[model samples]
Target: MRDLKDIELFLLDMDGTFYLGNKLLPGSIEFVDTLRKQGKNFMFLTNNSSNDSESYAEKLRKMGLDGKIEVFTSGDATGIFLKERYGTLRIFLVGTKKLAKTFEKYGHKIVQEDPEIVVLGYDTEINYEKLAKACIYLRKNLLYVATHPDINCPSLEGPLPDAGSYIALIEKSTGRLPDYIVGKPNPLMLEMVMKKTGVSREKIAMVGDRLYTDIEFARRSGILSILVLTGETTLEDLRNSSIKPDIVVENIGELAKLLQKESGE
Candidate 1:
């Protein structure tokens, strides 16, 4: 594993790494402050595509964290990737209207019928009729794409159905899955992060609580991974998991302390 000192960028997970809903984790702010003091850069990266970057930035502000409008989401990365690969293709979207607007903003044609691609996202407003239409479109051989494969989204209330859950249902019904999933653990997301930050894979670190989505992403992308036990995964889960993070701490507070210790501050 590479030393944390070598990291130039920190790609933080929102739900687990920063705040769990309405509350910010202990030391999250301190960690960021420490990083800023050291002239390091960081960004919040989430697999949730139900809302746009602006919404996330607002949420961060409400949580007492200073953030910008350029906060990254799986939706943003997926939209950019799709536009580069399949420009001007008509897409049927199974996401919030906001996500559809994201696609439209990228110059992709959004259509309800006879689409060339059916893109799935975390649609909080999903209905049975929308699911039926998406399945029908897939049955008709439309190419499928998923923004992320996260089965559950962590919230203050608890876990709720995310985009991956909906994708599972559609795949089970139509006996087909998305041709591409453009989220965590997929190199495309890391590529997008690197492009946006001007950081190479070797100089970035991914910090989160989930092993599969967060640690696995770092492992696959050849970046450092730090797992915090303050969220979903427990210490036992870490011991048994095949995908191991380079560093494991109780929370961001402990991580900040470690950094302070390393720098002799």
Candidate 2:
């Protein structure tokens, strides 16, 4: 196992790992502060494709995390992936207005009629009509893509259905699965991180609360994984699971202390 001190880049999962909903998790700010003080690199990474980066950054700032925050969402990754692979084709995006604007920001044409591809995201504004249109496109055998494969997103209420759940519905409707699911565990997000930060695989660590997306992503991408108990996974879940992280902590607070200790602060 690589030492915590050796991990140069920390890829933070926002929803459960760093913060739950609009509230910052305990020590989230401290963790980032410690990283900064130690001259380590970190970025807020999330699979939520409903909102853009500025929205997340503003949320963090409002939650008392200071500084110029850098955030990358699966929506951003999907846009990049589509742009690089298909060169700004017409897209039928089943997502929120923010997500549509995000696709447009990537230079893709959003068309309700005769789209070249059907893209699925974590559509918070998902409606029957949107799903019906996407299903029709899928039946026509247009290229299908999804932002992330998270079955459920952690919520203050409980685990809520996410893009993966929508995927299942679409599969049942059209008998078609996404041609590509571009998010955690697929290595696409990590590749984007590396491209942006020039960070090597071994030196990066994925820290999150979920075992499947966050830890599995680290496992597949050859990066260290740190699981926190702040959301989703319980100790029993960890013990019975095949997927395991390199490190475990009660919360980001514990991890922050570790980093501070490591830096001799």
Candidate 3:
């Protein structure tokens, strides 16, 4: 609560926190607007590596979200990690078009036959050939990297298999895990956010619905955190967890008001 005034940037989650399915969550936009009016900046920092930022921008635009706002994804964070660490490595990327595009844009070579490193993202287009090839690569002792470690992604129907599931399968098959998981809860995502926003750790507040990824990212990165109940987390979920968010609210709308009051807006 006392940290609200110190927050110069808000890192928000999208799926369950801001929207569900195709519908925007109540007060999501008003919250952003109010934050903007308070001279505070915010960015949607999603662990969903299924889509690229441009696709996210389009989706947000349809929800009356401003198009100019920067949206970061796990894929984007991975891109930065690779560009700095192994940009020249021939990479076998098991991911969607967006993830492939992210790597390509960073000048990383995408290969299928015995890559130096195998990067995994939320490949919704995942097939046996890709998975088998990934397993084969793992068997050969190639470096493995995952975009994020989410076990399931929430959907309108139910939870769907995410990157963590794939990692588990590959690990079971080859007895190898990712050399590095370059997304939320790892602090690499927060490093990327810091580089992009030019905002220091103390000035950034991570707001989201998930405890393990979102709130854990904040805790690990020394960034303030707010957990909203408008998503996968309930009050019960909070009480059962060891990770404590700095603030809790029914929705981002409520947080906006609290921030306004704290900032004297």
Candidate 4:
């Protein structure tokens, strides 16, 4: 409650928080508009590593939001993390062509053979050869890292297999799991967010609908967490879960009104 006044940055989860499927939630635009008008910072923080930031930016543009707004993904985090931790190294990237470009942007050479490390992302363009090579590398005991743990990605038709699903298959084949998963609920993403935004944990808030990823990420990162019952979580679910959010609202629309009142807008 009191923390909202001090928050300089709002790290938002896209799918379930800002919109459900293709439809934008109530006050989705108004909340962001209000934040911009008040000179606060916000970023679309997503775990999807299949698509690059530009793809997400385009998606947002089609959804009636400003495409030029800042967007970050688990792929961005993984690339930055690898660069900072290991400098430039040969990476066996199992992801889309867009994702390969993302790693290249971080100065890492994407190679097919003799990779120093193996990185698994949401590879929408995954093929048997890619999987076979990833499994072979994992079997060789190379450093393994995955983008996120989400097993399924939401789509207009239904839930589609995501990176985590591929992780499971690779694990089964090589009997090895990822050494590190760099995504929500890991707190690594939050550290990257802090480094990029130059915002203190005390001045940041995570707004999302999922208790496990979004709220847990905030709890682990020592930032304020706001849960909106507009996605995967329900009030009953909250009552049953040990992981709790700092604040709960009916929806983003309600939270927007509250923010307006707090700011005397």
lDDT of each: 0.88, 0.92, 0.88, 0.89
Error of 3 at 246 (Å): 0.7
Evaluate model 4: give its lDDT. Answer: 0.89
Which stretches of model 1 miss by more than 4 angstroms? 67-70
Deviation from native of the Cα of residue 36 in model 1, angstroms = 0.8
lDDT of 4 by residue, 68-134 (tens): 4888899999999988998998999899999999899889999999999999999999999999998
Q: Report the poorest 10 consecutive residues by lDDT, candidate 1.
A: 62-71
Best-to-worst order by TM-score is 2, 3, 1, 4
Cα-based RMSD of candidate 1: 1.4
**Alpha carbon lDDT of residue 187, candidate 4?**
94
User: Which 10 successive residues of model 4 have the least lDDT summed?
Assistant: 1-10
Q: In candidate 2, residue 147 scores what lDDT?
A: 96
Model 1 clash pairs are none
Superposed model 3: Cα runs more than 4 Å off: none
Stretches > 4 Å off in candidate 4: none
Best by lDDT: 2
lDDT of 1 by residue, 38-79 (tens): 778888888999998878889888888874434799988998
Q: Give the TM-score of candidate 2.
A: 0.97
